[model samples]
Target: MSEHQPLSVDGQPQQLNQDEATQLAEELKQQIRNGVIPAGDSDSIERMVAGLGDPRGLMRLTFAESLGVVGKAAVPSLCRALSEHDSVTVRRAAAKTLTLIEDPRALPVLLKALLNDPDPVVQGSAVGAMAAVGAEAIDGLLEVLINPNSTAMQLGLASWGLAFVGARAPEALRNAATSDHAEIRCAAIAALGDQIQSLDDSEARGLVEQGLKDSDRDVRAEAATLLGKLHNPAWAAPLLEPMLNDPEGQVRKNAALSLMKLQATASRPALDVRLSQEDQTDVQAVLKLAINQLDQAG
Candidate 1:
Protein backbone atom coordinates (compact mmCIF):
# COMPACT_ATOMS: atom_id res chain seq x y z
CA MET A 1 0.00 0.00 0.00
CA SER A 2 1.16 3.54 -0.74
CA GLU A 3 2.17 5.92 2.10
CA HIS A 4 -0.79 8.14 1.20
CA GLN A 5 -3.23 5.21 1.00
CA PRO A 6 -6.61 5.89 2.59
CA LEU A 7 -7.46 4.22 5.95
CA SER A 8 -10.48 2.50 4.49
CA VAL A 9 -11.55 0.88 1.24
CA ASP A 10 -15.06 0.62 -0.19
CA GLY A 11 -16.71 1.76 3.12
CA GLN A 12 -14.73 -0.69 5.29
CA PRO A 13 -11.50 -0.26 7.23
CA GLN A 14 -8.38 -1.61 5.53
CA GLN A 15 -5.29 -3.08 7.21
CA LEU A 16 -2.16 -1.02 6.78
CA ASN A 17 1.11 -2.74 5.88
CA GLN A 18 4.28 -1.73 7.80
CA ASP A 19 5.29 1.11 5.48
CA GLU A 20 1.73 2.32 5.17
CA ALA A 21 1.21 2.19 8.94
CA THR A 22 4.45 4.10 9.59
CA GLN A 23 3.59 6.78 7.04
CA LEU A 24 0.02 7.11 8.36
CA ALA A 25 1.28 7.42 11.95
CA GLU A 26 3.79 10.14 10.99
CA GLU A 27 1.19 12.12 9.06
CA LEU A 28 -1.27 11.85 11.92
CA LYS A 29 1.38 13.01 14.40
CA GLN A 30 2.22 16.03 12.27
CA GLN A 31 -1.46 16.87 11.98
CA ILE A 32 -1.76 16.60 15.78
CA ARG A 33 1.23 18.90 16.22
CA ASN A 34 -0.39 21.36 13.82
CA GLY A 35 -3.55 21.42 16.01
CA VAL A 36 -5.63 19.03 13.90
CA ILE A 37 -7.21 16.04 15.63
CA PRO A 38 -7.75 12.81 13.72
CA ALA A 39 -11.26 11.78 12.80
CA GLY A 40 -13.03 9.55 15.33
CA ASP A 41 -15.52 8.20 12.84
CA SER A 42 -16.22 4.44 12.81
CA ASP A 43 -14.00 3.64 9.85
CA SER A 44 -11.17 5.88 11.05
CA ILE A 45 -11.21 4.42 14.57
CA GLU A 46 -11.33 0.81 13.31
CA ARG A 47 -8.44 1.47 10.92
CA MET A 48 -6.33 2.72 13.81
CA VAL A 49 -7.37 -0.19 16.03
CA ALA A 50 -6.38 -2.53 13.23
CA GLY A 51 -2.93 -1.00 13.15
CA LEU A 52 -2.54 -2.21 16.75
CA GLY A 53 -1.88 -5.66 15.31
CA ASP A 54 1.03 -4.49 13.16
CA PRO A 55 4.05 -6.76 13.78
CA ARG A 56 6.30 -3.72 14.02
CA GLY A 57 6.52 -2.61 17.68
CA LEU A 58 6.97 1.12 17.11
CA MET A 59 4.16 1.29 14.56
CA ARG A 60 1.73 -0.22 17.03
CA LEU A 61 2.82 2.26 19.73
CA THR A 62 2.41 5.18 17.33
CA PHE A 63 -1.09 4.06 16.40
CA ALA A 64 -2.06 3.55 20.07
CA GLU A 65 -0.83 7.07 20.96
CA SER A 66 -2.57 8.63 17.95
CA LEU A 67 -5.78 6.84 18.96
CA GLY A 68 -5.27 8.20 22.48
CA VAL A 69 -5.34 11.72 21.04
CA VAL A 70 -8.73 10.85 19.54
CA GLY A 71 -10.00 10.82 23.16
CA LYS A 72 -13.39 9.54 24.35
CA ALA A 73 -14.64 9.40 20.79
CA ALA A 74 -12.41 6.32 20.38
CA VAL A 75 -13.60 4.55 23.58
CA PRO A 76 -16.25 2.27 22.13
CA SER A 77 -13.99 0.89 19.42
CA LEU A 78 -11.06 0.39 21.79
CA CYS A 79 -13.28 -1.34 24.36
CA ARG A 80 -14.54 -3.72 21.71
CA ALA A 81 -10.98 -4.49 20.67
CA LEU A 82 -9.93 -5.10 24.30
CA SER A 83 -12.84 -7.38 25.14
CA GLU A 84 -13.73 -9.08 21.85
CA HIS A 85 -10.72 -8.98 19.56
CA ASP A 86 -9.16 -12.32 18.63
CA SER A 87 -5.60 -11.06 18.62
CA VAL A 88 -3.87 -10.74 22.01
CA THR A 89 -1.66 -8.01 20.56
CA VAL A 90 -4.74 -6.01 19.62
CA ARG A 91 -6.26 -6.54 23.06
CA ARG A 92 -3.07 -5.41 24.83
CA ALA A 93 -2.70 -2.35 22.62
CA ALA A 94 -6.35 -1.43 23.06
CA ALA A 95 -5.97 -1.50 26.84
CA LYS A 96 -2.75 0.57 26.70
CA THR A 97 -4.33 3.17 24.43
CA LEU A 98 -7.30 3.43 26.76
CA THR A 99 -4.82 4.09 29.58
CA LEU A 100 -3.74 7.24 27.76
CA ILE A 101 -7.35 8.13 26.94
CA GLU A 102 -8.24 7.64 30.66
CA ASP A 103 -11.98 7.86 30.05
CA PRO A 104 -14.34 6.49 32.72
CA ARG A 105 -16.61 5.20 29.98
CA ALA A 106 -14.09 2.41 29.40
CA LEU A 107 -14.17 1.28 33.05
CA PRO A 108 -16.70 -1.56 32.82
CA VAL A 109 -14.92 -3.18 29.89
CA LEU A 110 -11.52 -2.69 31.48
CA LEU A 111 -12.77 -4.24 34.71
CA LYS A 112 -14.12 -7.25 32.83
CA ALA A 113 -10.78 -7.73 31.12
CA LEU A 114 -8.92 -7.48 34.41
CA LEU A 115 -11.10 -10.15 36.01
CA ASN A 116 -11.67 -12.61 33.15
CA ASP A 117 -8.96 -12.23 30.53
CA PRO A 118 -6.94 -15.42 30.04
CA ASP A 119 -3.79 -13.60 28.99
CA PRO A 120 -1.65 -12.23 31.85
CA VAL A 121 -0.45 -9.27 29.78
CA VAL A 122 -4.03 -8.37 28.83
CA GLN A 123 -5.14 -8.58 32.47
CA GLY A 124 -2.20 -6.46 33.65
CA SER A 125 -2.76 -3.84 30.98
CA ALA A 126 -6.47 -3.67 31.77
CA VAL A 127 -5.74 -2.95 35.46
CA GLY A 128 -3.14 -0.37 34.41
CA ALA A 129 -5.82 1.34 32.31
CA MET A 130 -8.11 1.30 35.33
CA ALA A 131 -5.32 2.93 37.36
CA ALA A 132 -5.04 5.70 34.79
CA VAL A 133 -8.80 6.29 35.13
CA GLY A 134 -7.91 7.48 38.68
CA ALA A 135 -10.53 8.10 41.41
CA GLU A 136 -13.40 6.75 39.33
CA ALA A 137 -11.76 3.32 39.32
CA ILE A 138 -11.45 2.94 43.11
CA ASP A 139 -14.73 1.15 43.72
CA GLY A 140 -14.16 -1.41 40.98
CA LEU A 141 -10.59 -2.06 42.08
CA LEU A 142 -11.66 -2.44 45.72
CA GLU A 143 -14.42 -4.82 44.72
CA VAL A 144 -11.78 -7.06 43.20
CA LEU A 145 -9.58 -6.77 46.27
CA ILE A 146 -12.49 -7.72 48.51
CA ASN A 147 -13.52 -10.78 46.51
CA PRO A 148 -12.51 -13.96 48.33
CA ASN A 149 -12.20 -15.89 45.09
CA SER A 150 -9.77 -13.43 43.52
CA THR A 151 -6.37 -15.03 42.83
CA ALA A 152 -3.21 -13.77 44.50
CA MET A 153 -2.09 -12.18 41.27
CA GLN A 154 -5.44 -10.42 40.88
CA LEU A 155 -5.26 -9.22 44.46
CA GLY A 156 -1.75 -7.86 43.85
CA LEU A 157 -2.84 -5.98 40.72
CA ALA A 158 -5.92 -4.54 42.43
CA SER A 159 -3.76 -3.41 45.34
CA TRP A 160 -1.36 -1.80 42.87
CA GLY A 161 -4.21 -0.02 41.06
CA LEU A 162 -5.68 1.06 44.37
CA ALA A 163 -2.31 2.54 45.38
CA PHE A 164 -1.97 4.30 42.04
CA VAL A 165 -5.33 6.01 42.57
CA GLY A 166 -5.15 6.36 46.37
CA ALA A 167 -4.26 10.03 46.48
CA ARG A 168 -7.50 10.82 44.67
CA ALA A 169 -9.70 8.69 46.94
CA PRO A 170 -8.32 9.18 50.43
CA GLU A 171 -11.69 9.07 52.15
CA ALA A 172 -12.71 5.95 50.27
CA LEU A 173 -9.41 4.25 51.00
CA ARG A 174 -9.56 5.28 54.63
CA ASN A 175 -12.98 3.64 54.87
CA ALA A 176 -11.63 0.55 53.16
CA ALA A 177 -8.76 0.35 55.66
CA THR A 178 -11.31 -0.37 58.39
CA SER A 179 -12.97 -3.16 56.44
CA ASP A 180 -13.88 -6.48 58.10
CA HIS A 181 -11.97 -8.43 55.48
CA ALA A 182 -8.22 -8.96 55.91
CA GLU A 183 -7.61 -8.86 52.15
CA ILE A 184 -9.34 -5.50 51.91
CA ARG A 185 -7.43 -4.25 54.93
CA CYS A 186 -4.11 -5.36 53.48
CA ALA A 187 -4.79 -3.65 50.16
CA ALA A 188 -6.02 -0.49 51.90
CA ILE A 189 -2.89 -0.27 54.05
CA ALA A 190 -0.80 -0.34 50.91
CA ALA A 191 -3.06 2.26 49.28
CA LEU A 192 -2.86 4.49 52.32
CA GLY A 193 0.94 4.26 52.10
CA ASP A 194 0.70 5.65 48.58
CA GLN A 195 -1.47 8.47 49.89
CA ILE A 196 1.13 9.16 52.57
CA GLN A 197 4.00 9.17 50.08
CA SER A 198 2.36 11.60 47.66
CA LEU A 199 0.40 13.91 50.01
CA ASP A 200 2.25 13.38 53.27
CA ASP A 201 -1.25 12.69 54.48
CA SER A 202 -1.27 12.87 58.27
CA GLU A 203 -4.55 11.00 58.49
CA ALA A 204 -3.12 8.24 56.32
CA ARG A 205 -0.03 8.04 58.53
CA GLY A 206 -2.28 7.60 61.54
CA LEU A 207 -4.18 4.84 59.80
CA VAL A 208 -1.00 3.01 58.83
CA GLU A 209 0.11 3.21 62.45
CA GLN A 210 -3.13 1.55 63.45
CA GLY A 211 -2.53 -1.08 60.79
CA LEU A 212 0.73 -2.08 62.46
CA LYS A 213 -1.41 -3.47 65.26
CA ASP A 214 -3.99 -5.27 63.11
CA SER A 215 -4.92 -8.81 64.17
CA ASP A 216 -3.91 -10.26 60.82
CA ARG A 217 -0.18 -10.87 60.33
CA ASP A 218 -0.42 -9.88 56.63
CA VAL A 219 -1.99 -6.57 57.57
CA ARG A 220 0.70 -5.87 60.17
CA ALA A 221 3.40 -6.91 57.70
CA GLU A 222 2.01 -4.62 55.03
CA ALA A 223 1.93 -1.76 57.50
CA ALA A 224 5.55 -2.37 58.44
CA THR A 225 6.52 -2.50 54.76
CA LEU A 226 4.69 0.77 54.09
CA LEU A 227 6.35 2.68 56.95
CA GLY A 228 9.77 1.42 55.84
CA LYS A 229 9.24 2.87 52.35
CA LEU A 230 8.30 6.29 53.73
CA HIS A 231 11.47 8.34 54.29
CA ASN A 232 10.46 10.20 57.48
CA PRO A 233 13.02 8.80 59.86
CA ALA A 234 11.74 10.61 62.94
CA TRP A 235 8.20 9.26 62.46
CA ALA A 236 9.03 5.94 60.81
CA ALA A 237 12.03 4.97 62.89
CA PRO A 238 10.19 5.11 66.20
CA LEU A 239 7.29 3.17 64.68
CA LEU A 240 9.48 0.59 62.93
CA GLU A 241 12.05 -0.04 65.67
CA PRO A 242 9.39 -1.73 67.78
CA MET A 243 8.21 -3.93 64.87
CA LEU A 244 11.43 -5.90 65.20
CA ASN A 245 9.56 -7.67 67.96
CA ASP A 246 6.67 -8.62 65.61
CA PRO A 247 5.77 -12.31 65.71
CA GLU A 248 6.01 -12.78 61.98
CA GLY A 249 9.57 -13.00 60.70
CA GLN A 250 8.62 -11.29 57.44
CA VAL A 251 7.29 -8.31 59.35
CA ARG A 252 10.51 -8.05 61.34
CA LYS A 253 12.64 -8.40 58.20
CA ASN A 254 10.65 -5.70 56.39
CA ALA A 255 11.00 -3.43 59.42
CA ALA A 256 14.77 -3.78 59.32
CA LEU A 257 14.84 -3.01 55.59
CA SER A 258 12.69 0.08 56.09
CA LEU A 259 14.95 1.26 58.91
CA MET A 260 17.88 0.82 56.60
CA LYS A 261 16.13 2.82 53.89
CA LEU A 262 15.39 5.64 56.31
CA GLN A 263 19.00 5.61 57.56
CA ALA A 264 17.67 5.33 61.07
CA THR A 265 21.06 5.51 62.75
CA ALA A 266 19.52 5.77 66.18
CA SER A 267 17.97 2.31 65.67
CA ARG A 268 21.39 0.65 65.63
CA PRO A 269 21.01 -0.41 69.25
CA ALA A 270 17.59 -1.90 68.48
CA LEU A 271 18.95 -3.75 65.44
CA ASP A 272 21.81 -5.21 67.44
CA VAL A 273 19.38 -6.43 70.08
CA ARG A 274 17.07 -7.94 67.45
CA LEU A 275 19.96 -9.66 65.70
CA SER A 276 20.96 -11.44 68.88
CA GLN A 277 17.42 -12.73 69.44
CA GLU A 278 16.06 -13.34 65.90
CA ASP A 279 15.56 -17.05 65.24
CA GLN A 280 14.80 -16.75 61.52
CA THR A 281 18.06 -16.66 59.60
CA ASP A 282 16.55 -14.31 57.04
CA VAL A 283 15.46 -11.82 59.67
CA GLN A 284 18.84 -12.13 61.41
CA ALA A 285 20.65 -11.35 58.18
CA VAL A 286 18.51 -8.25 57.50
CA LEU A 287 18.95 -7.03 61.09
CA LYS A 288 22.72 -7.32 60.66
CA LEU A 289 22.51 -5.34 57.41
CA ALA A 290 20.46 -2.66 59.16
CA ILE A 291 23.10 -2.42 61.89
CA ASN A 292 25.90 -2.23 59.33
CA GLN A 293 24.06 0.47 57.33
CA LEU A 294 23.43 2.54 60.46
CA ASP A 295 27.11 2.33 61.52
CA GLN A 296 28.06 3.59 58.05
CA ALA A 297 25.44 6.36 58.33
CA GLY A 298 27.14 7.57 61.53
Candidate 2:
Protein backbone atom coordinates (compact mmCIF):
# COMPACT_ATOMS: atom_id res chain seq x y z
CA MET A 1 0.00 0.00 0.00
CA SER A 2 3.09 2.22 0.13
CA GLU A 3 3.21 4.85 -2.64
CA HIS A 4 5.60 3.94 -5.46
CA GLN A 5 3.54 6.29 -7.62
CA PRO A 6 1.86 3.80 -10.03
CA LEU A 7 2.91 1.84 -13.11
CA SER A 8 1.64 3.48 -16.25
CA VAL A 9 0.41 1.22 -19.06
CA ASP A 10 0.90 3.93 -21.70
CA GLY A 11 3.60 6.65 -21.71
CA GLN A 12 2.98 8.82 -18.62
CA PRO A 13 5.15 9.58 -15.58
CA GLN A 14 4.72 7.69 -12.26
CA GLN A 15 5.80 10.93 -10.51
CA LEU A 16 8.10 9.04 -8.08
CA ASN A 17 8.90 11.48 -5.25
CA GLN A 18 11.37 10.72 -2.41
CA ASP A 19 8.79 8.72 -0.41
CA GLU A 20 7.83 6.69 -3.45
CA ALA A 21 11.38 5.82 -4.48
CA THR A 22 12.15 4.76 -0.90
CA GLN A 23 9.00 2.63 -0.70
CA LEU A 24 9.79 0.89 -3.98
CA ALA A 25 13.39 0.35 -2.98
CA GLU A 26 12.43 -1.12 0.43
CA GLU A 27 9.82 -3.52 -0.92
CA LEU A 28 12.31 -4.71 -3.51
CA LYS A 29 14.81 -5.28 -0.69
CA GLN A 30 12.41 -7.35 1.44
CA GLN A 31 11.27 -9.48 -1.49
CA ILE A 32 14.92 -10.19 -2.26
CA ARG A 33 15.77 -11.25 1.33
CA ASN A 34 12.70 -13.46 1.29
CA GLY A 35 13.91 -14.98 -2.00
CA VAL A 36 10.80 -13.73 -3.78
CA ILE A 37 12.57 -11.11 -5.89
CA PRO A 38 10.84 -12.01 -9.13
CA ALA A 39 8.11 -9.71 -10.55
CA GLY A 40 6.06 -10.54 -7.45
CA ASP A 41 2.31 -9.98 -6.89
CA SER A 42 3.01 -6.38 -7.94
CA ASP A 43 5.01 -7.19 -11.13
CA SER A 44 7.58 -4.57 -10.10
CA ILE A 45 10.29 -5.73 -12.50
CA GLU A 46 8.00 -5.59 -15.54
CA ARG A 47 7.25 -2.01 -14.61
CA MET A 48 10.98 -1.28 -14.44
CA VAL A 49 11.40 -2.99 -17.80
CA ALA A 50 8.75 -0.75 -19.30
CA GLY A 51 10.34 2.23 -17.62
CA LEU A 52 13.45 1.33 -19.58
CA GLY A 53 11.41 2.27 -22.66
CA ASP A 54 10.83 5.82 -21.42
CA PRO A 55 11.73 8.24 -24.20
CA ARG A 56 13.90 10.40 -21.98
CA GLY A 57 15.53 7.43 -20.16
CA LEU A 58 15.04 9.46 -16.96
CA MET A 59 12.74 7.05 -15.14
CA ARG A 60 15.06 4.12 -15.78
CA LEU A 61 18.07 6.01 -14.52
CA THR A 62 16.13 7.06 -11.48
CA PHE A 63 15.30 3.46 -10.67
CA ALA A 64 18.93 2.47 -11.10
CA GLU A 65 20.14 5.45 -9.08
CA SER A 66 17.73 4.65 -6.26
CA LEU A 67 18.68 0.96 -6.20
CA GLY A 68 22.34 1.88 -6.06
CA VAL A 69 21.59 4.29 -3.22
CA VAL A 70 19.83 1.57 -1.23
CA GLY A 71 23.10 -0.41 -1.15
CA LYS A 72 23.25 -4.11 -0.07
CA ALA A 73 19.55 -4.33 0.52
CA ALA A 74 18.95 -3.92 -3.21
CA VAL A 75 21.47 -6.52 -4.41
CA PRO A 76 19.09 -9.43 -4.91
CA SER A 77 16.59 -7.28 -6.77
CA LEU A 78 19.31 -5.78 -8.94
CA CYS A 79 20.56 -9.28 -9.65
CA ARG A 80 17.06 -10.36 -10.53
CA ALA A 81 16.80 -7.52 -13.03
CA LEU A 82 20.23 -8.30 -14.37
CA SER A 83 19.17 -11.88 -15.09
CA GLU A 84 15.51 -11.54 -16.01
CA HIS A 85 15.13 -8.06 -17.47
CA ASP A 86 15.56 -7.40 -21.19
CA SER A 87 17.38 -4.12 -20.80
CA VAL A 88 21.10 -4.65 -20.76
CA THR A 89 21.54 -1.07 -19.55
CA VAL A 90 19.55 -1.89 -16.45
CA ARG A 91 21.67 -5.00 -15.98
CA ARG A 92 24.83 -2.97 -16.42
CA ALA A 93 23.61 -0.43 -13.90
CA ALA A 94 22.74 -3.28 -11.56
CA ALA A 95 26.29 -4.59 -11.92
CA LYS A 96 27.65 -1.17 -10.99
CA THR A 97 25.24 -1.03 -8.06
CA LEU A 98 26.47 -4.42 -6.84
CA THR A 99 30.02 -3.07 -7.00
CA LEU A 100 29.04 -0.26 -4.68
CA ILE A 101 27.30 -2.65 -2.31
CA GLU A 102 29.98 -5.35 -2.59
CA ASP A 103 27.38 -8.09 -2.31
CA PRO A 104 28.76 -11.65 -2.18
CA ARG A 105 25.55 -13.11 -3.60
CA ALA A 106 25.88 -11.15 -6.82
CA LEU A 107 29.31 -12.62 -7.52
CA PRO A 108 28.11 -15.84 -9.14
CA VAL A 109 25.68 -14.12 -11.47
CA LEU A 110 28.28 -11.51 -12.31
CA LEU A 111 30.70 -14.32 -13.11
CA LYS A 112 28.05 -15.80 -15.37
CA ALA A 113 27.50 -12.47 -17.05
CA LEU A 114 31.21 -11.93 -17.46
CA LEU A 115 31.57 -15.24 -19.31
CA ASN A 116 28.16 -15.90 -20.79
CA ASP A 117 26.26 -12.66 -21.25
CA PRO A 118 25.75 -11.87 -24.94
CA ASP A 119 26.26 -8.17 -24.40
CA PRO A 120 29.84 -6.89 -24.31
CA VAL A 121 28.89 -3.94 -22.09
CA VAL A 122 27.32 -6.35 -19.61
CA GLN A 123 30.43 -8.56 -19.81
CA GLY A 124 32.74 -5.70 -18.82
CA SER A 125 30.22 -4.48 -16.27
CA ALA A 126 30.19 -7.94 -14.74
CA VAL A 127 33.97 -7.97 -14.66
CA GLY A 128 34.00 -4.77 -12.60
CA ALA A 129 31.18 -6.08 -10.43
CA MET A 130 32.90 -9.42 -9.73
CA ALA A 131 36.03 -7.51 -8.81
CA ALA A 132 34.09 -5.49 -6.28
CA VAL A 133 32.52 -8.63 -4.81
CA GLY A 134 36.01 -9.33 -3.38
CA ALA A 135 37.61 -12.35 -1.62
CA GLU A 136 34.55 -14.34 -0.66
CA ALA A 137 33.56 -14.66 -4.31
CA ILE A 138 36.97 -16.04 -5.37
CA ASP A 139 35.97 -19.70 -5.23
CA GLY A 140 33.23 -19.00 -7.75
CA LEU A 141 35.67 -16.99 -9.83
CA LEU A 142 38.17 -19.88 -9.97
CA GLU A 143 35.39 -22.27 -10.92
CA VAL A 144 34.77 -20.06 -13.94
CA LEU A 145 38.45 -20.26 -14.85
CA ILE A 146 38.52 -24.08 -14.72
CA ASN A 147 35.36 -24.53 -16.77
CA PRO A 148 35.99 -25.34 -20.44
CA ASN A 149 33.31 -22.96 -21.60
CA SER A 150 35.12 -20.16 -19.78
CA THR A 151 37.88 -18.67 -21.85
CA ALA A 152 41.33 -17.25 -22.28
CA MET A 153 39.70 -14.15 -23.70
CA GLN A 154 38.29 -13.50 -20.25
CA LEU A 155 41.60 -14.20 -18.55
CA GLY A 156 42.18 -10.54 -17.68
CA LEU A 157 39.07 -10.62 -15.55
CA ALA A 158 40.01 -13.98 -14.07
CA SER A 159 43.41 -12.58 -13.19
CA TRP A 160 41.86 -9.56 -11.51
CA GLY A 161 39.49 -11.80 -9.58
CA LEU A 162 42.41 -13.95 -8.41
CA ALA A 163 44.30 -10.88 -7.30
CA PHE A 164 41.26 -9.70 -5.37
CA VAL A 165 41.18 -13.04 -3.54
CA GLY A 166 45.00 -13.14 -3.15
CA ALA A 167 46.55 -16.48 -2.04
CA ARG A 168 43.23 -18.28 -2.01
CA ALA A 169 43.36 -18.62 -5.81
CA PRO A 170 46.93 -19.98 -6.04
CA GLU A 171 46.24 -23.63 -6.86
CA ALA A 172 44.15 -22.75 -9.89
CA LEU A 173 46.77 -20.22 -10.95
CA ARG A 174 49.60 -22.75 -10.75
CA ASN A 175 47.70 -24.94 -13.19
CA ALA A 176 46.74 -22.10 -15.50
CA ALA A 177 50.30 -20.83 -15.98
CA THR A 178 50.74 -23.75 -18.35
CA SER A 179 47.34 -23.48 -20.00
CA ASP A 180 47.32 -23.74 -23.79
CA HIS A 181 45.82 -20.32 -24.31
CA ALA A 182 48.62 -17.75 -24.51
CA GLU A 183 46.68 -15.01 -22.75
CA ILE A 184 45.57 -17.40 -20.02
CA ARG A 185 49.14 -18.55 -19.49
CA CYS A 186 50.34 -14.97 -19.37
CA ALA A 187 47.50 -13.87 -17.14
CA ALA A 188 47.99 -16.83 -14.83
CA ILE A 189 51.73 -16.25 -14.65
CA ALA A 190 51.27 -12.53 -14.00
CA ALA A 191 48.55 -13.26 -11.47
CA LEU A 192 50.79 -15.66 -9.57
CA GLY A 193 53.48 -13.03 -9.32
CA ASP A 194 50.97 -10.47 -8.09
CA GLN A 195 49.62 -12.92 -5.50
CA ILE A 196 53.05 -14.00 -4.28
CA GLN A 197 56.05 -11.74 -3.93
CA SER A 198 58.44 -14.66 -4.23
CA LEU A 199 58.12 -18.18 -5.53
CA ASP A 200 60.26 -21.10 -4.33
CA ASP A 201 62.85 -22.14 -6.93
CA SER A 202 60.83 -25.21 -7.85
CA GLU A 203 57.60 -23.30 -8.26
CA ALA A 204 58.96 -20.59 -10.54
CA ARG A 205 62.13 -21.81 -12.28
CA GLY A 206 60.56 -24.28 -14.69
CA LEU A 207 57.59 -22.06 -15.38
CA VAL A 208 59.98 -19.19 -15.99
CA GLU A 209 61.89 -21.28 -18.48
CA GLN A 210 58.78 -22.42 -20.30
CA GLY A 211 57.30 -18.96 -20.28
CA LEU A 212 60.52 -17.42 -21.57
CA LYS A 213 59.98 -19.59 -24.60
CA ASP A 214 56.28 -18.79 -24.98
CA SER A 215 55.25 -18.20 -28.63
CA ASP A 216 53.60 -14.89 -27.79
CA ARG A 217 56.06 -12.08 -27.22
CA ASP A 218 53.77 -10.45 -24.65
CA VAL A 219 53.43 -13.67 -22.68
CA ARG A 220 57.16 -14.21 -22.70
CA ALA A 221 57.65 -10.62 -21.57
CA GLU A 222 55.16 -10.93 -18.71
CA ALA A 223 56.80 -14.15 -17.55
CA ALA A 224 60.15 -12.42 -17.56
CA THR A 225 58.72 -9.56 -15.50
CA LEU A 226 57.15 -11.95 -12.98
CA LEU A 227 60.43 -13.82 -12.70
CA GLY A 228 62.14 -10.51 -11.92
CA LYS A 229 60.06 -10.21 -8.77
CA LEU A 230 61.39 -13.55 -7.51
CA HIS A 231 64.45 -13.05 -5.29
CA ASN A 232 66.05 -16.45 -6.03
CA PRO A 233 69.38 -16.65 -7.85
CA ALA A 234 68.52 -19.92 -9.57
CA TRP A 235 66.18 -18.01 -11.86
CA ALA A 236 69.11 -15.81 -12.89
CA ALA A 237 70.66 -18.44 -15.20
CA PRO A 238 67.31 -19.41 -16.70
CA LEU A 239 66.52 -15.74 -17.28
CA LEU A 240 70.01 -14.57 -18.36
CA GLU A 241 70.22 -15.38 -22.08
CA PRO A 242 66.68 -14.10 -22.61
CA MET A 243 67.64 -10.65 -21.26
CA LEU A 244 70.04 -10.10 -24.13
CA ASN A 245 68.77 -12.49 -26.78
CA ASP A 246 64.96 -12.48 -26.79
CA PRO A 247 63.31 -11.12 -29.95
CA GLU A 248 61.23 -8.66 -27.95
CA GLY A 249 63.19 -5.75 -26.50
CA GLN A 250 60.91 -5.45 -23.45
CA VAL A 251 61.25 -9.14 -22.67
CA ARG A 252 65.01 -8.90 -22.76
CA LYS A 253 64.90 -5.76 -20.63
CA ASN A 254 62.64 -7.41 -18.09
CA ALA A 255 64.94 -10.43 -18.03
CA ALA A 256 67.86 -8.11 -17.31
CA LEU A 257 65.92 -6.48 -14.47
CA SER A 258 64.97 -9.90 -13.11
CA LEU A 259 68.56 -11.10 -13.24
CA MET A 260 69.59 -8.06 -11.24
CA LYS A 261 66.85 -8.90 -8.75
CA LEU A 262 68.73 -12.12 -7.99
CA GLN A 263 71.66 -9.80 -7.19
CA ALA A 264 74.02 -12.06 -9.16
CA THR A 265 77.31 -10.77 -10.56
CA ALA A 266 77.64 -13.89 -12.64
CA SER A 267 75.12 -12.49 -15.09
CA ARG A 268 77.68 -9.98 -16.48
CA PRO A 269 79.32 -12.22 -19.10
CA ALA A 270 75.96 -13.19 -20.63
CA LEU A 271 74.83 -9.53 -20.69
CA ASP A 272 78.10 -8.39 -22.34
CA VAL A 273 77.55 -11.00 -25.01
CA ARG A 274 74.10 -9.56 -25.73
CA LEU A 275 75.26 -5.91 -25.73
CA SER A 276 78.10 -6.66 -28.11
CA GLN A 277 75.90 -8.82 -30.31
CA GLU A 278 72.23 -7.74 -30.04
CA ASP A 279 70.74 -5.00 -32.28
CA GLN A 280 67.95 -3.51 -30.15
CA THR A 281 68.65 -0.33 -28.14
CA ASP A 282 66.28 -1.56 -25.43
CA VAL A 283 68.31 -4.72 -25.11
CA GLN A 284 71.38 -2.54 -24.71
CA ALA A 285 69.75 -0.94 -21.69
CA VAL A 286 69.58 -4.37 -20.09
CA LEU A 287 73.25 -5.04 -20.93
CA LYS A 288 74.26 -1.83 -19.13
CA LEU A 289 72.27 -2.82 -16.00
CA ALA A 290 74.10 -6.14 -15.92
CA ILE A 291 77.49 -4.34 -16.01
CA ASN A 292 76.30 -2.01 -13.24
CA GLN A 293 75.15 -4.96 -11.11
CA LEU A 294 78.46 -6.75 -11.74
CA ASP A 295 80.40 -3.67 -10.61
CA GLN A 296 78.31 -3.37 -7.44
CA ALA A 297 78.60 -7.07 -6.54
CA GLY A 298 82.38 -7.04 -7.16
Candidate 1 lDDT over 79-138, as tens digits, reads: 888887788999999999999998887888888899998988998999999999877788
| Candidate 2 wrong stretches, greater than 4 Å | 1-16, 22-76, 83-93, 96-125, 131-158, 198-206, 213-216, 232-238, 241-243, 247-250, 260-266, 289-298
Which digits, one per residue and each the tens of the lDDT, describe model 2 over residues 225-290?
A: 776666657745656655457777888787787777767677777777777887877677767876
Candidate 1 residue runs with Cα over 4 Å from true position? 1-34, 148-152, 275-281
Clashing pairs in 1: none
How do all models score by TM-score?
0.83, 0.56
Judged by lDDT against the true structure, how good is candidate 1?
Answer: 0.85
Evaluated against the true structure, the overall lDDT of model 2 is: 0.63
Candidate number achieving the greatest lDDT relative to the actual structure: 1
Clashes of each: 0, 0
Q: List the residue pairs that clash in candidate 2.
A: none
